[model samples]
Target: MKRTTSSKRCNYVLEKLKLHYSGTSYCNCFEPPWLCPEVEECVWKPESNKSKQFTNAVNTWIDLSKKTNNLFIKKQLYEWLDMNHANILAVDRGLYPVERFFPLEKKGIFNTFLGRIIMEILPPCKNTKGKNKILHLLSKACPKRCQIRNLKEIVLQYATEDDQTYLFLLEVMKKSLLGKYNHCKVQLQFEGRHVFYQMFSYQISQKSFFLKWFENGNHQIFLFFCLKEYLCDAVRQVKTVYDYIEKHWKWSIFDKQVVKSMDNCRKILNTISEREYNLLHVSDWISSIESFLLQVSKQHIKLFRTTNAMGYISKLKVNLNKYIISEDLNVDIRQDVSRFLWEITQRTTDKNVFYYALEVLGLEREVVEKVKNEIFCALDYKMLSPNDLFTLKEFCRVIELHKSTYNFVLPKHYYDKQVLSLKKRENKNNQAIGYICFICNDIKFFLTKLSDSSRHSNKLARGSLRVVVDNDISCCHENNLKFVCGKKPERHVKNSKKKWKNDKKALTRKLLKEKQRNFLSKQCIQTPLQEIDLLGHAIQFNNKMIMLCSSCGNVCMLDPESFKYSVNINCKVCHVSPRDICIKCNTETTCNKILVYNQRRTKFHKAPMCNNCTNVYAQKQPVVI
Candidate 1:
């Protein structure tokens, strides 16, 4: 009968053959004979079968010897073994060589080396076959079990290398792993090689599938731990790279692709937990970078027009304010950030620059004099006229709101002073005229009337207890007697009846003469009264109107008796009266009292008291006295 052997039996035979050649043997003495299928197969092959058996035995021995010999090959074929063979070898020899066959699976060489170093320092299993063995073991081990010290040591070892290529590879590996993990704990030492390595590593590592796991998988816990490890490893390196770029790279160096890539990276970083992703103090580093970029942007603003540059600057200002005011950052760092923003404002010409500077000053409570001076010094006053600059109403509003903090000096004040100086120069060319009284307060109208009368050849008269003036005075009512005078009083009247008789005769003659003169003057010069709107209020030159408040000491022009007593009247203080007397004091001295009114006037009338009196009365208590 033909003999058959199971694959496991065949494998057992082959393993035994290898041991036997090396002077070792396995004794399965107590096992059943049926299990020894190789022995049965050997017995079944006889004669011609004997020749085949000898050949088969020799070939199996040779194959086992060759397998042993491959372990020491200079270019070990084990590194190139297929997955199935590698898995089998991993089970037999352990995971060390197996990882070599799948080097890309373990992050990268840098990550693998780091994994091995960790294993060496706090090894999962002490006797690893090679560096790759430790990596393979770490991959299978729980992420929480991974020691932070070992990760830090691996990063430091490779990061310490001055070689650009080695550093680049190290960074690439770190970035690749960071894509998958959010909270890595590696500390990258800053150097030129390291920065370049990090940038390039980020460029390449974004494409890794391990990175996709964090993005695509539902294993939130696993994803978080992986991300933690990666961020811990990459944050310091990323900051170093950005710092170098900010200082050394020009704006032109940032093409759309690079900027887009940077934005994408930022977005991805933002998506991760801030606590975990901040292992390298990346927020501080990014703030520094933003500050540098803001400076560059401000310096290059001349390359763009005012409007376009303003748009760009607005975004920078927003980012800058966010950084400066972020409570998560240190106070000193925020201060520095604020200073940098101020510097950016100084270099910019856009009007919004000052607005942003104002906001910064408001936020930081900074003295913005330097920024203001710089802006004014660099501005093209010729290009932008005073009026044009003033047209930025929003800027003016901001200045008004924060002028104290920003130390904003009003431009209008300076302009007015300049204009006054010019007016003085013009006045020097003209001769002095008669003094015109400056009416500051209560007697403005009377002073204006006196000045007008003096300009004409007007005569003066006396009425009741007051003196009045007119052109060619007539109808004087002094001591209840009337008299007409073409000139100043020469003598006093003794009899009241005779004074009235003489005044009537003189006034009649004066009126006839004045009418003739007025008609003649009317043809040459229009009457000043023609411009006055007489329909509203009747002008009364002489009336004994008593006023409770000195401010309301003018005659009531409205005829209270002509219309009903409800007729509205404006008082001397220009207040509208709802009632006949002062609404505030409720004093009935005269209807000429000042009245208060608003737009909805025929509405409830407010009291006619001054603001000061009202305030005092509101706070005062009635005295027993």
Candidate 2:
């Protein structure tokens, strides 16, 4: 042992040599097959060596760049996978080559490029560990320092030409990292890629993870993504239509129409997208596609119907109201029916249904005319009420009303505010051009005079009031011309002989107070025979005393003695008229019987007049026999 070169290699190097030797057993024809370790022993790794297989897989994909044909194939393959060409070459050249991370005592695989490649190599089968294995490989792909931009590059490199693979990768990422990190930001290379990433629930993940994705954006991307697996072909078709609409449709005019029309398409997408695991039956997909197309067709019909109606009306150069209203239009409907229709129109949400109901009742013309008049009155006065505008909107949905007719009409307060704004703008322009309000000019002249009067009072005179040169006629006069009073504190006075002070003055004040009390007491005196009238007050009209009724504006002569004695004067015309006149014939009539108007004893006339005049007052008041 002293003379011999007794050297020992590290256990790791020894194991590695053994592994390499076992792998090359087929290369050595002279070697005994039984002497070589099994294939499992050669490739299989312990928990301590989890990244060994992961590194081999990544190296297998990464080493392809050594050959030109394989490199070209790899480039084109990744390009079709919705990956940037430059990114592939950079990773292939080891400029940010596939990285492997392993925890000190954890049992997880590497997150290298071929770790993702192994997913396609080992597709899902009856094996339960398939998902766990896929996730185990992808768990550590992103390092602690990695952000969304780099994450996009790393994750997208693993994408394949197949859409299902990208979707599956997204699913795996969503399940694994979604809990740890809310979402990842993925920027597409180009438009029309049929990739919708915003719609995914990445927002529901951890704020720290999402913030990292959201904050670091080296690229621009659209929001709202979708991963359509079921009815994928139908979704593509819908996407084509959506692109056309988005590009060509006049958004201002057709925004609501487009949104309404595509509701069914959105529902279809949502239904298909909910199935994370691809185990749906063919019948299910077919049924979903059929309903989706059916809904789309229905919405299409609705949109076409509305647009065609609009176009026809536009070409005719007439309004919906003009079409409905006519000189010869007969509105001979029942009063109750008209009332009912008005109530229904106010309450009805669906304008089309309301219009249809109006058409069925043959009252569309009357209703349209009424609504048109209300809208005109509201708009002309700029009424602050939204009731009429709401009615117009509800009616417009059924009749395809033009925006020009109703858009200019604002609520009363808003209209006034805008008018005031315009006036203020005009005033500003006037001020800028050296024009000023007359009141402001007058104040300026007065201030100059005051300043000239006292040289030292110039600043004080100028500081008295702020002058705004608004030339608007509606500007408040009081606002511009205000008087500022100086504050003066009252001086305290003390009298030593309080009892001997001003005896004559006190006696005069007491006599005045007694006279005032006597005058009011005499005016307030009332007799027992005099009836009280609560609704009327005495007034001197045309130099004569008269009792004025507040409720009905009737006046009656009051006797001087009654006026002095009565606390409240009663109107003879309203309370007890001297005579009654026939209402229909306008002639004096005699009373036959009293006509009761209602259960309450409140009659049309307050005085005992001819009951035949009941028809005159109550307009044919029926007598209760």
Candidate 3:
């Protein structure tokens, strides 16, 4: 067993080295693994012998090395040097090794939470950059009597106001906040010391300052930065859960594929313990982030606008080597790369319920493609993004003054937006057969699960399922259909009116019908859909019996006008609140989902906050729903 393991390690290292050395003279960021830093210190350490240990391997490595004739590679490993000293020894390879840059206190532990917090936030820190700089400041700048609890205050105390170190430390804090909860912020108060002597002796969170950010606080510094990161992460998780539930609700009502996937997710959520869920969540996030980083590495961009592209290129190469992207079905590499390069100047769902449900239930589709389309919709909706604006401005600038004929002009609709984007025009096109009829394309699958009878034809309790679009030959094909309801709305109808009149007569009629039917309060009024049905009184003569709108998820209704069979389907499903009703005032809020419940069909509420609460809590204090 030991020999076999040793052989595998040797082969792995050899393969990496082969790839590293095989690349061109111009490209050589990929290199050998690091040897033990204390190899010289330990008496038990074997002599630096490379050639004799792997005589056969060194010949191949040297041959590959000579082909490159790269100066960087030459400097690292000279021809005259002993092969043993040049080659890496994989003596202590582990899945994740524990290494620390900062020394332990006399008691053999990280003395304060500050150090540990810093270490935890900035990951893969084989280099002591964070620890070295932090330690250097803390060593002399920190007061012997009392250390400031705040990282910002501590920096200000030790360094001048204009020092760049403050910026660097801030960057570190920002990095630490990555993949953390949005609601993790905490506020700390210490009076009379004037930043110099203030220590994090008294800490308060935005939710409850009395409640410490971490489970434990052994530091004098308040570690408010740390708490803030965790809070952001918490808020993010809560929001994700809410979005998942909302999506599930929609799937249950409309899409058969999504319904089955959501059901599986529900079963998993119900069966699993909290510990398993936490593990799954962590796994999901890690995979998402790593995948993102790997995807970013594949593209070439005007990187960070540094004067010396060489250094940036070298760093980019190193990062690429570290986060290598292999062939994957689950990941749409092109889309991920495009998003990192062109679109994602803002946040989108990293791995939402849609993807997660499919992933856990072993259902396969182009899930990444679905996510990409969603991201595209989000980016286009904000209308001429800064990036888009800049590109347009720069293009025009060049055309006018620079005498460059790139001949790249913005699309006509890009400026006027005369043509509706797919997200906006989701309701009118369904060239496919059942799509025109407002039913699932895979009706056969649903039929297999349920007995074929007239009673169960409209399977859902309230409304029958149907495609969201109809009679647009331009969008009949699958390719056209996929993109159809994905366009951004031309303009937000801020005060969109309800179809019915606001008169006493209308109200009385609505109330009478509401009493006749066992109507739910928050439910969409049946009057509009009923009106749509009433429009086409028995006039369906073999075009296809239609029931729902697949494009905009509208069902059994006259979309734009009442009593008109020719009315083009207008999807209002996009306008419905994402069940984010504020708990305090029952108003729908934006992505505010701190509270969660297991039961289905309960109107999920949102949390509200005032400006004052925001200062006390981070970023609009998310009230518990």
Q: What is the lDDT of residue 14 in candidate 1?
A: 34
Better TM-score candidate (1, 2): 2
Please identify model 3 stretches exceeding 4 Å from their true place.
Answer: 1-625
lDDT of each: 0.30, 0.30, 0.28
Cα lDDT of model 1 by residue, 1-625, tens digit: 1233333433454344334434333122111121211332221111233233222332232233234543222112211121123322233233322222222222334443443333342222343333443243233222223233344334334334324323343344344322222222111111111232333334434434322332343222222223233323432235554354335432123222223333344443433323333244434233333343333333221111212223332333333323322312222212233334434544665765665555543422222333344343223323432322222222332232232122122244333433343244343212111111111001112211111122221111111111122343243233332211112222243553455566887755454444433322322121111111111123232221111111122222332221233223323232323233434455432212133344444443444443334454555532111
Runs with alpha carbons beyond 4 Å of true place in candidate 1 = 1-101, 104-218, 242-625
lDDT of 3 by residue, 90-128 (tens): 211212212211110111111333433333322221232
* lDDT tens readout by residue for model 2, 313-371: 23222332222232222222132333344456556556555556544554345544544
The prediction achieving the highest TM-score against the true structure is 2
User: Which scores greater on TM-score, model 1 or model 3?
Assistant: 1
